[model samples]
Target: MSGRFAELHLDQVQRAFGDTVALKGMDLTIKGGEFVALLGPSGCGKSTALNCLAGLLPLTGGRITLDGKRIDDLPPEKRGFGMVFQNYALFPHMSVRRNIGFGLSMRRTGKAELNRRVDEAVRLVQLEEHQHKFPAQLSGGQQQRVAIARAIVLEPPLVLMDEPLSNLDAALRLEMRTEIRRLHQSLGLTTVYVTHDQEEALALADRLVVLRLGEVQQVGSPEEVYAHPVNRYVAGFMGYRNMIPVTVGSQEGEHATVHTEAGVKLVGVKREELGSEAVAAVRPEDFAVVTEIGANTIEAVVEIVEYHGREQAVEARLRDGTQLHVRTNSRLAPGDTITLKVPAERVLVFA
Candidate 1:
């Protein structure tokens, strides 16, 4: 297959509902056979972007191109894009086989071709046992599988999924995530998935597009976005919990000394441009309980200990009232005075 068939491009895409702007000149280019996820909080216009790509919504400004052809003016049905919604939206009266064949039928495909495609899709989802069952008779996860089968039955060039697994329970969600990833790998389809769940995006996306208030915040691979966030918002969103205000005491060599409100001096490499005041971000896992003397060790009183299967999270407070969260395997009793070490490499300095 030609790579152009899977190519999708957006340039300066903008959408407005009357005076309220939903998307503000967004630009993105998704490569063929790549799984790109639009990840952000609610009302971030990720869905709007998807709608525009599917030709379900009109753009207020900018252009959308697919396979080197302008498609912003095309109708949804003419776009040849498969969409799986949060709600399965399956026909209660139609059997799973019939539902999967619905799209092919609409395209006036031959009965043999329709049946062949339906069978293929049903088997792909491993729903052959339920092929004769109606949507009402299937579990939430099964219903979602049918929805996916229906979307892929026609073999559209691009697939757009909007939180397709959100309705499932936790365990089922994980199962479906693995299934979807496997399916994408098998089909090599260019996919644009939208979800507010960070874990889902982190687990499934080859590239993540982070948005906030309809604007693109960052676009990178999951590891890049998680390990090196551009700002405090992105840092906190990626599970960097320990955020403390710090004043740059001095910059020497490759490291800078930051003074916290508790009068504790921390040595960390400055990742962001230095300012008089800044916020230091560090993940809980980056902190360790110090039994030996360390350069960035801080005296803390353990307030609470949370046991999380593999590790323990210690909630502590410094002498000058600075709250600290430390993660360590060493079990520390509550109210015990201990020292925690913040490693310089794991620290993120952001303004």
Candidate 2:
């Protein structure tokens, strides 16, 4: 290992393409042994930021430092950082063992040392049985394992993964997510992962840096970010499928009563500085079917219902013709009228 990675800092890091900027000034400090995810949708600069950190793309301004020393100017190979690309990127003809040891071989590592490290890497990824198989011979999951093994075999203190699980199927993605977490803990690697999937970021990251249009939207622990998004855009990204326009009627401490554009009164926790107009963001799963008319309740007609095993995913239209997504266990079909109530704490109002 390259000694223990103490800390990494991106100070005012920016990337520009001629007149168009792909990443804005981003400042972040990542502690050793921490898993930080760069999360956002397509064209959100998550990948641009990761590439900048990896020395794949030169920064337009600012600098990156590791343990208080500048490393952003170093070439990727000289930085001694391991990288796992989105695609497996394994050599088609090379055997798994050879692929895992390619970096060591390129550095002219001693034969015995190379064998030992490759063997350990193979075991770490639990691919001992297929060590002799070429990339074409392995399954997608197995190929991904080989890719991971290849990177870790170098014993780089910091690992950068660019949507490493994006190519896998749903089941395989979940499986590899667990595997990646295990490897991070067992090896004590400082990981910077880039992904557009919010759930994956929440599941794997100790901290999340949400980006939008090249600018950082928020940075917080998964629990904090998921429970309390800072803005309407972030709320939408974090699975709040319903965004209702409202006019604030009254404010009481941290709660606000607002009249919806459709003239329905609803209460929600105030999350930001509000003007007369604000948005009420609610996660579909937060809506509950209520039997009585109460605070924060909405009367809507079910437009669509889809089975999601434990709950039914519903698309409903409010009296004012606003569509809302709700997740409920109630047995309901299209055209059925239902009253969905969201707890005040569950509804977030943002200006």
Candidate 3:
């Protein structure tokens, strides 16, 4: 292997099982030392794409290359990629030290060199005291750390993780996200992570490749994808609420005037040119509970108030029975009538 790291380029990669297509024409490029995530819901083919890249599954069409050299034909064992599985697939009978050194042992490295590499990896993962324990003896988090160590000890140029934190509790998952970020920064490894969890992908990935029904829906940074999605599917998945259908009445530059089927007029911003038929979407926090109604204001009766300590999630319904969720600090009751104003720029119009 060369001393320089390699960028991965997937050119129209496709995977299929007979008539059932799992991945269709996936094209993505990951910069060297960058963290890329294959993000989507279950059955969206994110895992299939990851499997193809890891050489666990062959592509049905197109090519996968690293720094311009073809890699799709290589076997999983020859891919020189470290993998952290969801279950932390460590050998049950092996001690942590042995498990971490297994890859190097397979390559037949000298005893002194193997011990040095494994020791360094163990320290990097902060599992010094648990080095002698077996897989069953360590906490889920620690076992995962060992799995990560095993993957990184070889110091592979690329790292592949398949829903690595799914088995951990919520708190532990958050903790491991931080740990994974730290490792990525320190090691400067090109990483591809597969996850169905939106929060984890947003928190960990430098860039996101959102897939749906065997196709890429969007590819962007977390902020870009969350703030402005290209379509209704992506908007809904990115935490956008108020996905009601509306008819566009007029447009002034990026601003749009539209009305719901109930004749409720709404104003929002459109990133792309929108047709007469479009979807009006706004995030929960984008609305404010006003005391009075005016232009672009929605009158709603509070239905459910959920306390979230720092903020409250208020569910309300309009006169026309359109339900909305708003996050705010306003003290609200189920029977109270409130006015919500959505700023034009904070709203999204997706065609």
Q: Pick the candidate with the highest TM-score.
A: 2
Give the Å error, residue 289, model 2: 0.9
Clashing pairs in 1: none
Using Cα atoms with residue i matched to residue i, what is each candidate's TM-score against the true structure? 0.94, 0.98, 0.96
Question: Considering summed lDDT, which 10 consecutive residues are worst modelled in model 2?
Answer: 1-10
Q: Report the number of the highest-lDDT candidate.
A: 2
Count of clashing residue pairs in every prediction:
0, 0, 0
Off by over 4 Å in 2: none
> For each candidate, C-alpha RMSD in Å?
2.0, 1.1, 1.4
Stretches > 4 Å off in candidate 1: 1-6, 252-254
Whole-model alpha-carbon lDDT for candidate 2: 0.92
Tens-digit lDDT track for model 2 on 1-351? 375777899999999999999999999999998999999999999999999988899999999999899998998888888889998789888999999999999889999999999999999999989999899999999999999989888878788999999999999999999999999888888899999999999999999999999999999999999998999999999999999988999999999999987788888999998999999999999999988888778899999999999899999999888899999999889999988898888889999
